[model samples]
Target chain A: MDTDATYQAPSVDEIKTLLTERFAGKVNVTKTETRRVYATLPKEIVHEVCEYIHEKLTFEHISTVIGVDMVDYMQVVYHISNYHTGTMIELTTNLDNHDLHVQSISDIWVGGNWHERETYELFGIIFDGHPKLERLLTPDTYEFYPFRKSYKLRGQE
Target chain B: MAKDVLDIKAESAVMDTDKMWIIMGPQHPFSHGLWTLKIQVDGEIVKDAEPIVGYLHRGWEKEAEARSYPKIIPMADRLCYAASMTYTHLFCMTVEKALDIDVPEKAKYIRIVADEICRIQSHLMWLAAVGTDLGNFTVFLWCMREREFFMDLNVRLCGARMTTNYPRIGGVRNDTTELFDRDVMRCVERFEKVLMDDIVTLIDDSSVFVSRMKGVGYLTREQTVNLGITGPAMRGAGVDFDIRRDDPYDNYDKIDFDVPVMTQGDSYSRYQVRIEEMLQSCKIIRQAVQKVKALGKNAPYRLKVPSNVPAGRSTVRLEDPRGESLMYLISDGTDKPYRLKVRSPIFTNVSAAKPLVQGCRIADVPVVMAMIDMCLGETDR
Candidate 1:
């Protein structure tokens, strides 16, 4: 029933400007299409960026965390959303194989706690500052980080 | 504390205050899925609660990476078994978005209608479950009777009742038959006639039902927002946010429907939201059937889709029966996906049990959790 034409949301460009001003151009938004954004930010600024999204932007809905093994590096994707404005910003951060870790945003979004835990176990990415980061979906004895490209399963390459 | 633990009857004479731990499930009727609730109890009142999930974890996301785009649809269908059509359609929508495939107009209408039918069925399934959970066997029977119509309609539309792997990347798998629209309209009318009077009265007229659901399991609107709760649970907290209208997909924008919100964030309010939602689902199905009929003699349903999709990533969100279901798809310019990440609504919704279930009695756990309508298949996936 929210058919408000006057509900002017902050455009992607406006958000990009805010990011530039806040993080000193350290973040780069790759694409903005239909409420979804693909972006890369400094691993250190991950917490700050999430805080900004949670507080300043009012995008308090942190849906989940996803991690991908991109051969040379790992991609950490956080789906942050605002139900009112219909803004979905997919915050992406690249962590090299050398250091498969990044600061956690669970403090900003408590819902991100489980997501981070699941991501940590499946993709083996360490989320620093997460209070209880452990194996979530997989058992403690289950050794492999099955989501990684290198970890092959039966009947799978 | 140790003294109270040792001398049970003696301590009962005095101000006996002691805390003990209780594991509710890996197998319990209260838990709808393969999850456990560890509660610290002071007598009957819950001191603190922690939800343990992942018992039903099938590693669907990891499995999706190895399988082709189309191959994963069947797996996604099982994401939320109560509403299989919605999950499969959502997966298809994500895949279509990643590949930038244009769905045919008729197929879009079919998807919309089928999705609403699934919603009605899922909500009815939840109502039946909650009824059984709260000792209202009659309500459960009535809800299941009403739900049978929708299940029959689903079978008429697709081949299966629950695991309806009907939606495809480009469009739906097949076209609708003449019996689909006629049968759907007949069912909706018949359902509406009996929905308020016969079925709901079984739960509503009962004084015990009102007392059990009225003010129990309270969640504030602020807490709902901060905790990332979605669907009826969030709406019950008086948040006017419905993804169908706010973030429209599959001709939902064109269809005129109202999103229901209630001020009380209690068990009763959540029930009210679901009841209103079923009516809206019926409305949506009627209008969708009209749209399907308006297409007249001939209309394209299934658009041709390639086995190998172009490389791209898409983050898709939709209001599934339970809540806002999200699918993050990364296609690698091949038939198979690089990574397919699903964030099921019940995962986060179930995680909020520590906040929602705290301070209530152990007996209230079933009513509190049953209102959440947990499906661990999706949560664990």
Candidate 2:
């Protein structure tokens, strides 16, 4: 086991500044709370932004990927965590209704593979270049994306 | 006899040999829950594997979207029966964050006590599963025996044993019952002794148990982090992070406890991490109970918040027994949440089944997988 005794993790401001400097206007650091950073990124630059976070910032883990269906658009939320600093960055990306597609980050963080698969199955979001972007936790035969807001509950009209 | 044996070997050598895929669950005893593991095996060795979950999905997340905030408390209780309080507590915490209200001091201490108790109960259940998976009924029986005391503790705190819907949005359901602190201290002290003296001795002294879990299912610290594993499993792999300590919430920062981490990235280390965690939880329970008592009985345990949450987003993560479980809430200024997403620990941990079971013998599959401590309730949800 290697001890990280000398490793110094940058504070939240440093991370925000680093990201804003790298991605410029493409990356927007919306909110910064205790041990948490909320950022919004356009779908076009998600892949590069995530690569920078993983490779440079040392955010080792991807906590989860959540897909939400808005009436007019779609959203993908990625929670990335850096254990060294105990800080989590919430990366939210907006997708147009016509193109519910985004680059897959499974190559950078292997854990995102299953989460992408789940998002694809539930919200019909296509994760381009994902290793196996198939239905997960849902039957392949099930045609409908049950999680979409348009899909009504069992008793609802 | 030598000539006949040589003839038989020569004939058998010409026969075709190929890898076979064996599906192991959804009904198999090796799977503690409703899930299947399809393992590709060449003779006794597993070359690759796939885990299929969701037999119990029941559309939990979507179901939550339709129900009101308070109505989902009992539903959250059903997320994982083994450690229901943690899920409910997590759900309530997320809502409270959206509501932007702080629970009273007494409620925070009580939650800590309840959460620690739930952690012990969940770990004990996992230990029992590990025992049975490793072919030792005695260990299973003993663990279940110890777990029953915790279940009784749960009953004393709330009213239910398995799914104790004790945590409300602003606070817990109620304050500690009469003599609840006394009962918890007694149980924790007795359990500490039995676990250290009897259970630890039985497993540590037995060479069979030691050898079975010592080196099987190895994962490096990098792999553990990259694969998004958390909780004790990640701690065992040498990533020193615990949400309770590093990312404190709900008076966790106020409490003092040590997060047990093992550098060895093997099954045995994972087992040892959980065992040490149970002991640490005992220490936490003791301190938290005293804090609850210090606050006096008049202290408020539950706060009355508004029926509707403000339109916003709140995300909260807690150190669950299995791993770091997170809940993300999106409210639309209504009683019903716009979206409720649960990131179950087992959901990600089980995704690494291919790496976890690969390269091990078929017989070792159960023992190795047991270390992840499968729970379909939360995984499917």
Candidate 3:
């Protein structure tokens, strides 16, 4: 999904500069496109970015968080929306699929916990510090991650 | 003292014993479409509950990617069958947003009428099912009798009953007929008196229903918000947040009606809210019908949508009869959507059952679940 209509877009340089100034280089801001910015930071800095966006950039609500498998890597996308400013920032991170480790953002937004558990159950993504990481939708005996690209549907493998 | 010690030991032994688990259907009376709930109960009192989904999962998101833009309308209707029109309307609105298609004023008014009719029919069905759950079969008969009028009205307009694939990507399938307007008015007038009185006599007057439902399945406003509950359940919790009012789609902003919120947040409150909501829906339908009649048949009904929609994501929230139905549509400038995610209300409402049924008796489970009135198709899809 690429957009070419660059109408005074938010500058990546300014975003990166702000992140560096606030987070002291612990945060890595990667530019996906003129409109999409993917911020990857240490698990410890998740709260910091969440807090900074909520307070400074006015990203008031977490739209959704999608967990995807890149085969060897697991990617978690935090889709944040600034309803007042009409801007969206998709923060993403890649971790080893087997490790599947990350801190929970439930403390920031209470709604994040259920979605996180759903992702965990579907893709085997592990939220390290989540309050309850037990199976949310699937059966307890469900062994395989159902949403992975390689994960075959019934009788398809 | 020795007997007391022995009694304590016997109770501990009973608690430690292996409990029998019963798997209630992906097909059952309680389940509408397809979903399973695994329950571990020690003789009626449930110790634990787990919801098992993905039975009716057709991977609609993947299907949407393969289907052309206009072709996905029918599929959206199948997501929530009871309120099929709402799903189709939401999908159309989302695609219209992506393609930047402006619908005609006449089309908007017609759509509002159709959707409000769907809401009335859906709530009527809910009332029937809720009545059936409470061991009152006559209410179901009365509700179905009243509901047939609207169903016939819908068939007269769109030529279908349950699944009316009447809404299109740009606008709607057809213009309203003179007969359609007459039948709708007839249905509205009949429902205004008969159905309201029947609901009050059948449900509100019954002491059994009141005793069983008055304080059962309670969810506080704070808990409801935390659980992401929407629609009537959230309104029953006293939130007063209706998408029709908060984020007005179609001509909901122009219409006049109260959301009918209840502070009790119990099963009874939910039933009362839904009963009141049916009346409010009738009011909206009356206003929309008036608007449609004024516009007449010559008003524009069709719209033109671009072949390649703009590459953007849009989230459209509409007030479905059950709850707040959110559709997240992502397009990559192609005929097919890149991702189509549905945030169904039933899924969240059903999840709240885990907390609602924690200490209640087993007999109360069915009544409590009926109050939620979750359609398994919506939850699984």
Candidate 4:
């Protein structure tokens, strides 16, 4: 048998240690009130953390990737689920309102490509390194991001 | 006669070939609602496929933020019209979890019965549509004729056939009456024989249909998991993960049924799985009806949902016939939810098509998509 196969999976603390060592405490890790682990990492290290979690921890499926606009900065949250252990890892990053740039995780999971594109089209989050970063679930001629907090509804403020 | 001949000649000669883009939907008989598929095809082969959605986008999530918890129940019915009751049950169940409301045992059994009945109707509709796509017109007519019985039963139970907002937050809306129970049992008895005979005739009888679908549109187990495809689509690929069995919601743990799986992972396997699932749903409904009868109206028929719930989020997964449907509710200590995100199974299942449709023939695209049965309303919302 392979040595990697025989090795035990890393505990949650060990996973946290690896995350801290890689990002040097730039991430604000918070255990959500629920059973999920929520970590806010820098936009620069978003791809790296995703790679680490996917490769080392085997959180293979990115269940959901949503973008929330907070007027000043847009927040992108990747809800990754570990199928083996049945735990959810939420990785968050904030981008400036003027410059919304973050790395894409399509390389790790192909499912993230369309979801990230949806976020980009709905909230104007720029996902760098996405292979086919085109409009998904939106018209190509849509000029404004519909989900932004600054964008008012058709009749409402 | 000369004028008619000239008009026919003019109409035939008016074809412009700048890659004529024809809108196939938004009002076509094939489409359900206002979903338009812009197809740019060269002759019979498709060069480009674009799905234009948002025709039924009621801004459900945005509207949920403004409305009270009880008021959102009706809107949930519009999410997936075919499985409207299932969606409503999931929505109310998620809110019930955030409020820490425990549904009574009798309500749980009724909810299961209602859900199984809806599953049977959904699968029957899918079979009819699949049959129609394959030019088997008689099968479509027969399936609809059988489905009308269930629809009539639904109307008797909830006063509505398609949009039955019967399941509430704590429990169900109404108790099971003797008349409703007798109708359900009679339907189940008739459905058992008809379903078996129909599956044998419709699917097993035709060698041409089997040959056409046997190995077409195959999704390997690895690809299905990586693409996050769930429900019968994934089960047709031979993945043994059902939310009802894995995470038992609404007394599913108390019931006994086998999760049908197919290793072939093709359109044929999908058909087989759904057919087998209809039988399993019939069994579950029969058992649930027996249980409800034994319980004898002792279950609380109504639940008074709290005005204000705790400020938190809860994610609940329920197994719809399509697959595992997820509902995420975020409450801000108010009667209404701050965010109610529905991760529709059809949306993710349909996304797997871009990869599956790459090298297949153009005619197979609709068959593969129809097997998934993506509700455009759920996808846009």
Model 3 complex DockQ against the native: 0.17
| Poorly placed runs, candidate 4 (over 4 Å) | A1-42, A56-60, A70-73, A82-99, B1-50
lDDT of 1 at A24: 67
**lDDT by residue (tens digit), candidate 2, B1-381:** 766556767777886778899999989888998999999998899999999998998899999998999999999999999989999999999999999999999988899999999999999999999898988999999999999999999999988899898999888888889999999999999999999999999999999999999999999999999998888888999999999999999988888899999999999999999999999999899999999999998999999999999999999999999999999999999999999999999999999999988999999999888998899999999
Between candidates 2 and 3, the one scoring higher on lDDT is: 2
Worst lDDT window (10 residues) for model 4 chain A?
A1-10
The models' CA-based lDDT, in order, is 0.86, 0.92, 0.75, 0.77
Any runs in candidate 1 off by more than 4 Å, and if so which?
A1-9, B1-17
Candidate numbers, best lDDT first, in rank order: 2, 1, 4, 3
Query: Can you give the lDDT of residue B352 in candidate 1?
Result: 88
True contacts kept of each: 0.70, 0.77, 0.11, 0.25
lDDT of 1 by residue, B1-381 (tens): 775566767657786666899999989988877899999998899989989988888888878877888889899888888989888998989888877878888888899999998999899989989988889898888899999888898889887888988998888888887678899999999998788888777778999988999888999988887787888998999988888998888889989999999999999999999999999988998999999888874788887888887887887889999999988888878999888888888888888898898989988988999888999989998
Of 2 and 3, the candidate ahead on DockQ is 2
> Chain A: TM-score in each candidate?
0.88, 0.94, 0.77, 0.87
10 residues in a row with least lDDT, candidate 2 chain A: A1-10
**What's the TM-score of every candidate structure?**
0.95, 0.96, 0.81, 0.85
Model 3, range B260-296, lDDT digits (tens) per residue? 9999988889988998998998898888888888887
**DockQ agreement of candidate 1 with the native complex:** 0.67
Per-residue lDDT of A21 in model 4:
64
Q: Which numbered prediction scores highest in lDDT against the true structure? A: 2
TM-score of chain B of each: 0.95, 0.96, 0.94, 0.89
* lDDT score, candidate 3: 0.75
